[model samples]
Each structure stands twice: as C-alpha cells, then as structure tokens.
Target: MTVTRTLALLLALIAAAAFAPIGPARAQSEGPLRIEITEGVIEPMPFAIAPFIAADSSAEDYTGRITRVIANDLASTGLFREIGRDAHIGRVTSLDAPIQYADWRAINAQALIAGRASVSGGRITLGFRLFDVVSGQQMGQGLEFAGDVDDWRRMAHKIADEVYSRITGEEGYFDTRIVFVAETGPAENRTKRIAIMDQDGANLSYLTDGSALVFAPRFSPTGRRILFTSYDSGFPRIVLLDITTMRRQIIGEQEGTMTFAPRFSPDGDTVVYSLSVGGTTDLYSLDLTNGQRRQLTNAPSIATAPSFSPDGRRIVFESDRSGSSQLYIMPAGGGEAERISFGQGRYGTPVWSPRGDLIAFTKQHEGRFHIGVMRVDGSEERLLTASFLDEGPTWAPNGRVIMFTRQNAGGDPALYSVDISGRNLRRVPTETAASDPAWSPSLP
Candidate 1:
C-alpha cells in the first residue's frame, strides 16, 4: 500500500480499537482526564507510553529514542507522571492491536499513548494515538507525522505537543527554541557569545564567536531572526542577526549615543529599545520599513527594557521615574505612562506575556532577588522565585512558565525555570555558564 493509504488505514484501525467497550477494571471517575494547574498542591496524573512498534528494521534505531524524548517532555511539565514500563501488564506489539484498557486501569494509568514508527527512503513516519484510559475513550483522533530521519527528535516533540495540548487545553512549548548569552572563563574576564538551543538544551550552536560582548538576545516573532546588544565597537548597540544567513546589521545607531535592550514589536516590523545620550536614557521605537524613529519615553530617569504587548497596542518597560526602578506601561505610539509595579522591591526587565494578560519581571529587595509576575494592571502580583539573584524573566509561549537567570553568591549564572504557580523550579541544562535567556515563539 502507498504510504498515505497505509497511514490512513493505521489510524482507522487505532480509532476502532480506541472506542472499544471498557472492561471490568474501568475507572469510576466519569470526568475527562485533565489537570487544573493551581496554587494548591497537585497530585500528578499517571500516564503510560507503550514502546513504539517499529514497522521495519530501519526504523528500530529510532523508536526507542523518540519514545524516550516524548516521555521526558511530558514528565518535565510536573503535571504528568510516567508509569514505568515494568508495571505495564500488556505490550503494544502492533499498531492495529486492541488496547487492553483493563490492564492500564488496573495500574491506575489515567492516560495511555501508543505509537508506531516506519522508515523508508531516508524519511521516517510516526503515528500515535492518545487514549483517556479513565473515560475509556480516545482523547483525540489518531495523528501522524513524517520527516527526515535526522529530524526524529523534532517529530517526537511534535507528538508530545499534541498530547500536551489535548489534555491541558493549552498550547505546548516543546517544539520551541531558546536564545541566550553563553559565558565561559573567570568572572572578571569571561567571554560571552550568542548561542541558541532547543528548549531541552539540545542542538546547541553558537551564533557568534567570543570576540564581542553580547547580551539580551531576543527572538523575533517568527523565530527567524534575533535582536541583541553587542559591544563590538566599544559601545553598546542594538544588532539584528538573521538566523538563516548569519548576516548582522547594527540598528538604532546614533552618533555619540548608545542603544540596547532591544525587542521586536508584535508584527516584527518595528523594534523597541532604550537609547542613551548625554547620560539620559529613553525608550524609542524604530520602524524597519522606512527607518523612522519615534521616542516613546522622554524622561530624565532611566527607562529601558521595553517590551511590546501581544496586540502591539501598548509597551511595558522598566524605569526609575518613581525614584527607584519600577515597571510602567504606556501607549505604543508614545504618551503619558502609568506605573504598574507598587511592590516593595525594585523591579526591572519587564516582559509582556504572549497571552497579553500578565507581565513578568525581576525584582530586588532586602538582599534577595526574585522573578515575579502580575496582572497587566499590576494587581494580583505573585513572586515565583527568590534566590541570591534571579533576573530577566522570559515567558514560555503558553505563558504558563517563566525562565530566568539564577546566580548564587560567588557563583556563575545559570538558566532556571519555574511554573507560574511557584512550583517545579528546575535548572535548565547548558554546556557553559549562561544568562539572558529569550524564549522563541512556538515553531511552525
């Protein structure tokens, strides 16, 4: 059979098996399998993944690797727990085999994922189905993905994204990327380079050599370009780098002035950044199409770290206009601003969430640093982390998690992420000391 027809037949068969009647050991709960992320302690839902059946010898090498990545992706979220394979009473030997729902429910598995893999002519195809074991029904229709063999990991991430979205009702961040500044050597003479990596710290590649000091690498909305502050010419300047061509151009440049902390507008056609001239710093927006600059904030105090709202209607940034560093919101076209942070600490590095409902920022007070978030109007302020130093909070694509740089006393900085609910704080793996993490939007 042709590959397309074969895939369709496989999905039809799985759909048939997924709808079969539940046996005697079915769960008592009639509610759909779901997790509500809240402030209270949550018991992780248990899920199982059967070994992906390999359709051919060429596919054997990838089945285990793909399955492991999928499991890790779900487990890292702190919402799903994996039921070890040793506890599985039934094996998934074929894509068309009927699911033994009784065996899965007997082990308290609320969700079951079964997959099949096939390889032919330098391409690999993956098909999977997610079943809500407790409800004894398929959570969604069976789906399949095909890609080059070298992109197996991305395929696995795509599958995980589907499963995550189906159960959590939120977009998945598994297939996104992160851009950061990679540091090496002593604290005083460290070399910083622009680096990019997969969300799980894989496929690491340096975009720039350690010759110039790079900071605050921000991804464009399309994830095809980057904006960062570079000190290559002995002064900080905003530089735009194209990921596909590796071409760099200095933007927002002015004679005898410095510009930094740049971010792209929602439409990716304009850049908002801080410009410093004559010891006075202000925020400015530049249109990429016609090279027109519009001053957003004209304050005597420092105003920097400008971020645009998702709708491109307003901008949120940090300033000391109130006698200390604090976050403020103003119209995107430049007008009167309003202070949004009234907390005890000094706030800076404000980032507007992709959802446009909240803002994430870094705060410092009484010898401790924190990463926090608050509603757009500065209500319901919540601090998600407190440490010796935590700064530069970046939201995940779904706006459910925030990643920032954490540093202990007399130690190098590392990337750390925490759920918005103030749980599941964990370090992000990287090869060297890293900071200034910028999360890219979900890939197409």
Candidate 2:
C-alpha cells in the first residue's frame, strides 16, 4: 500500500472480526447456565457483582476498585449487564460468608460474583468466585490471584477472565496489551510515537520518542519484540525493538531503499514487509535467526500489508494488481495469489485473525472509510465501523473484539473497539491520540 491514498488506506482498517456475539441465558434453574458463542441473540446476561470483601481492614479501597474493574471488564464485552449495587437485596460482608442466591435471583440476577481481597507485605492476594444465581450453584472453581500491590488491575482482569471463561467457554482477553502509534500536535504536523498500554488504555509507556514518524507497530507473538516502520534514518525502514530492554535494531538493510509495513511471522523469527524500488513495491521476508532473505511477492502491482495466518500456512495481503487496491491471499511460502475482495470499495491493510478464520481490512468507498472483516475465503464481509477515517484493525487475543483507529477531519485519531457482532462500540481510553494499534497476546 502507498501512502498518498491507496497506501494510506492500507494503514487504516483496524477492525474485522467475523464474530456473532455469544448469548448468555439462564436455561433452567439447575441446568448449566452457559453461553454458546456461535449463534444467538445478544441480550447481555444479567449479573450482580458484590463489592469484594476486605479480608483485612486495610484492603477496603482495593476491594472496591477491584470489583469495579471486574464489572467494567464484563460490561465492556456487552455480554453481561452488571446489576447495580443499590439494586441488590443482600450484601456480602465476609470473605467466607454464603451468598444469598435467592435474593440475587429475586432481583433477576442470573449470575452472581463475589470476591475477597487482602493487602499484606506490599502484595495483594485476590480470590473470586462466580455463581449461577438462578441455579444456586458455583459455576466453576474459584480463582485466586496474587501479585504486587500495583498490579491490582491485572488481578481483577484475571478474575474477570475466570468468570468470563466459565460462562462463555471462550478464552478471556482482559489481560492484554495494545501497542500503537501515539499521536500529538495537529493533523498537519502530527508527531507520532510508539506507545504501549493495557487493553483498557492503562499503564501507558512510550516506546519511542516522537523525533521520527512511526507506523504499524506490531507485537511479536511472544510480545517480547516489536516490529514497526520508522523514519529515524530519514527514510522509512523496518526496525525491531526489544520490549524489556528498549533497544532497537534496523533490519533488512539495503544501500538505499524503502522498507516498511513490517509484521512478525507466526514463529516470530521472521518478518514480512514491503520494500519499495523505483515505482513499485513488493513483499519480502527477513529471517531474524539466520539473516536469510526471501522475496515473497514480485508483482509489478503494488503489494503491501502482508499478515501471516496463525498456522503460518497462508498469508493475507493488500494489493493493487486488479487495477485497484483489493485483498489477496497467497501461500505463506509465497506463490501465485488469488484476489479475495470483490466489493465496490478499495480494500487494504488485511490482517488475519488469530483464530485463523477471518481477515480484517480497511475499505474506502463512496468517499467514506470503514473497518470491516471477511471470511478467510473473502465471504461474509461485514463492516463494523464507518467514519471519516477508520483503519488498522487488530484483534483481541481471543479474536472476540477488534480495535482500530477512528479519525475525524482535522482532528487527531483515537483508538476505538467494537465487538465482532458489530455491537458495543467504544473508545479505548488512550491518554493521547493513537492509531495503528496492534493488540498483544495475553501476558504470561
């Protein structure tokens, strides 16, 4: 993809999940209250979260904050409607107390959550349980998370994950990080820096100074190294940065050329990117282990924005070979390609979902921009967001949600997320304007 319009369009399409939201329900009083994610009408399951009991007197603030975090995480999914505290007929006051399931059921709570928190020795130990209020039974085994005091938010997310997983049967994505280009200044002279933060926009830290322009910062599958394009050397080049050490190395060096749009392979040992020469660009892969180079695409038509499937058997990329920009798929080893997108709009920036099912893309048609997803074979295309500019869709680790950048004319861009079902559209609370968000896999 080129930067003027078509290439620029490639950087923007940060959506695309082929998800029909899971529907939760209380089937029978004693039957397992589980949600099947594949096919159902989404009427968020009603759940009540009691303020976590402070096992220690000093744990009061943490108890409240942790419960709120858990509730917020569940609410954000649009899968659970948190019952307000004031609406509850009973309260949880002791960590070992029995839950009044009848009271919760009387208030129409299908699920109930109770937790306990203790602060000691500069560490926080949190334990939580999820119950099927209607059935008056524990849904799953209770979980306990212990960490340093400052890691309270993550602990809460872990609890939420347990509850979500117990109910939905899908893995949770709450304990994840999103790395993106943090923007500042005006639309004309914007300074972009690579920043990392929690999935909810907490714990933000800049990975790069804004002295240079950066784009498409993707996390390695291991989340230890990052691949991105930067203009630090006065020309666009692909660079790799270590997350813990903050050291960077420019890869695939050439005498004089442009190398951009970098992404880690499934193995995280190779990077696939676009190299520009003369008037055309092609895809190339650089193996980090042996410094081996391989040309993946040699199309005279511009080919960029290549993303590898989860199994590394296939690749999805954006190309302009068909007289216009469209999505194309090829073998991960590189070979003849097949055009995938046959829509009215121009498609670019195709990223494969982690689940290896859908490819999310950015499209421009009829003057407006959108972030959308299509099946692996390019069927079931669904646009999740429409805006003046929406691009760069990265999948949550679970692939249940997609986050992309949304920009209005003359305004800085902000990160936004929408469910795969095209519901629960919300802004990621980034501290600054952000774009090209690449969601990190869950932390260890």
In candidate 2 the C-alpha lDDT for residue 307 amounts to 95
**Backbone collision tally, model 1:** 0
- My TM-score estimates for the predictions, one after another, are 0.93, 0.91
Each model's lDDT comes to 0.88, 0.84
lDDT (tens digit, per residue) of candidate 1 on 413-441: 99998999999998999999999999999
Q: Which candidate is the best by TM-score?
A: 1
Which regions of candidate 2 fall more than 4 Å away from where they truly are? 1-31, 38-40
Give the CA lDDT, 0 to 100, for residue 41 in model 1: 82
